[model samples]
Target: MRIESVHATPGVSGFYFDDQRAIKRGASQDGFAYEGDPVTEGFDAIRQAGEALLVEVELADGTVVRGDCAAVQYSGAGGRDPLFKAEEYAPVVEGPVADAVTGREAEEFLANAELLEELTVDGDRLHTAIRYGVSQALLAAAARARRTTMTDVVADELGTEPAAEPVPVFGQTGDDRYVNAEKMFVKGVPVLPHGLINAEEKIGSDGEALLEYVEWLVYRSRELGPEGYEPRLHVDVYGMIGELFGAPYDRDEVVDYFAALEDAAGDLPLQIEGPMDVGDREDQIDAMCDLRAGLADAGVDVDVVADEWCNTFEDVRAFVDAGAADVVQVKTPDLGSVHRSAQAVRYCEGTDTRAYLGGTCNETELSARACAHVALATDAAQVLAKPGMGFDEGFMIVENEMRRTVARRERDRSRAAEEVTAGD
Candidate 1:
């Protein structure tokens, strides 16, 4: 099948983009907005509405496939691309992007995605958002052209088996940690609340606040969670732990503190993301390695997750190669093309490091759904439920999409079995 035309539209993302640098500097939250000056170069304000560029590719049969281009909530931090402004990028999608894919064979996805990912405009690569969304549309187009699910398209191209069941979904609790966590326990999310403990105040000056929160989280899960409910506890500190402990991450005190956190969580598995930023990628990796080694030495059963400096595919490899993290987040948008996320996830197959097929709360339904296909196709350890901090909507979209894909694959398998019986 050949592509007919391409269209682009500026739209709103599910969440706001915050200047991570400003937030780290102790920007106070006033209502939903922050009261501080923007610290990132492209950010005009400390917080602004997130934007998405919607790419629609019309196939030859008049069927249009869609993808949403979005950036992370904390853009321009951790070596990510600058903030994504949909209005500024819509023209690029309509012009060179459209020109590149138009009239090309739509039945194959990998080559087209690679071509678009490497395409440069004005002596620079297309913004990561553009590459993300366009690649999603192309994947959808390939599935449509072949009369298959997007999951199957990805699996076939990448030489992997599609997941037989839904990937475990991880829920985020934003600032409403208590209430949203209740929702997750009730819903039986495999990974419980992603406590957004991103600031010094949130984690507490001495980290007492976080310890208390972990204890409460464990207690509440037993109190309200359904029968046989056991979920992993993941808290993203955004590097506040590093700030509090003042690294040389293998210090006796730091190891003791992690042991305390494990004790607070009782028996539930614990994973901490971005324990310390440390400003540079190499330094961040070294710090995480030191922390992991320390935890092992102290016999603390805690998983250190690498986030911050691990933005690109190369960065993920670096972390995985050194065994810096127990889990490495394959932040989808930061990786540019969707296939890269799949590649990153599969890369962890033989390593001690596991892939958390993660993205931001700022993505759209289209992007989230596309990632659902990727997660299942790659059989990732856990897939983040996202597009917003609100627990219900993101979970429903991702979980339902994976369920539906599984149902369809099952139906196909049964039909093929019956056909073989009839022929025999």
Candidate 2:
């Protein structure tokens, strides 16, 4: 189907930084999570507003589609601001970005998506969010052309079908995470707790300290969590693992350390993400490879997840080729297009490595549900609940979206079967 017009509108979500790095770094005191403007102000609770751009596309065939692109909240080592990203890029989406897609076929717009990167409206490169918003809308429009759900469109493009069940949802754990962990575990949801290297205490400086923290995390989880729910104890180190050796990332120490943490985790499944922030794309890949090799050599069961610098289709493929990570965290916004994100999922599937459909708490309900559709279609290992970062809301939106997707796909399948029988 051909695109008729693309419209851009403002959207926002109430959210908090997954990690308030700037505020944490500036804090003169140790311990406690910091948030809010005048971030010098500290609060035990974290909640903020995240801005987004909603893209709606109308097709000549009379079908309408909508998608969302959310800003990054809690940036890592060096991350961009949500306001700056939204403000700087909105004009491009409504102007040149939309202009590029208008009057073109949906598939045609996607095939030439790269040209948008080169054809900047001003000096600024097309923002990632704009690319994501436009591509998502196109995907939805293509689904309309096929008279199927958005998940089906992604599945067709990936040469696959939606999964038999909803993708597993992984919940994020903040300062008040244990409280949520108990609730999530009771409900059988997996949790990725970041209290490991909180602003209150820096980990990785001491092997023993890291072990103790892991032990503490596990002990509390088991203590508070439901007995039958063997939820995954996924932890995100965010490069703190690199500091354990005081720099120059010692491969052997890292391996031994993860082995120890796995031991502490016992039967609970443990996956460590961004253990070491080595820097840049090349260095990150190399460092991850070294870590992965060391873990293999040590026969450690800990799965290493790559997030830093694994922001695009090419980056994910390179990491997969080099065997840099055991789990590839493909955040939707970073890849821009849902098509590219799906491609990353298929690439990881080709290898033994797993693909985790990840997005920040800075996303929106629209973005989360859209990504859930992609995850359902691509067979992603697990999909993260985001935009709100809270355990309950993110999980509910993503899980509900997948449930509806599966139901729609089943209905579509049954109709096709009945049509075939009628012809017979």
Name the top TM-score candidate. 1
In model 1, the runs with Cα more than 4 Å from the true position are 247-250
Q: State the C-alpha lDDT per candidate.
A: 0.93, 0.72
Clashing pairs in 1: none
Would you estimate the TM-scores of all the predictions? 0.99, 0.86
| Candidate 2: segments with Cα more than 4 A from true spot | 14-49, 61-64, 75-83, 106-119, 194-213, 216-228
lDDT of 1 by residue, 1-424 (tens): 9998999999999999999999988899999899979989899999999999999999999999999999999999988999889999999999999988899989979999999988999999998889999999999999999999999999999999988999999999999999999999988899978889888778888889999999999999998899988899999988888778875243567788899999999989999998888889999888888888989988999999989999889999999999999999999999999999999999999999999999999999999999999999999999999889898999999999999999999999999999999999
Give per-residue CA lDDT, model 2, range 1-424, as digits (tens).
7888887777775464443454444343335433343331332334344567778888897777888767555533233323324555567678897788788776543463555545566676666677676677777776677677778777766688679899888887654555766667567776556443543255534756656766766676666666666777777776777766647488887887888889988888889988877658899889989888888887898888998788878888988999999899897777767778888898887697899998777777878888998898898999997656467888899999899888877887899999999999
Per-residue lDDT, model 2, residue 3, is 84
TM-score of 1: 0.99
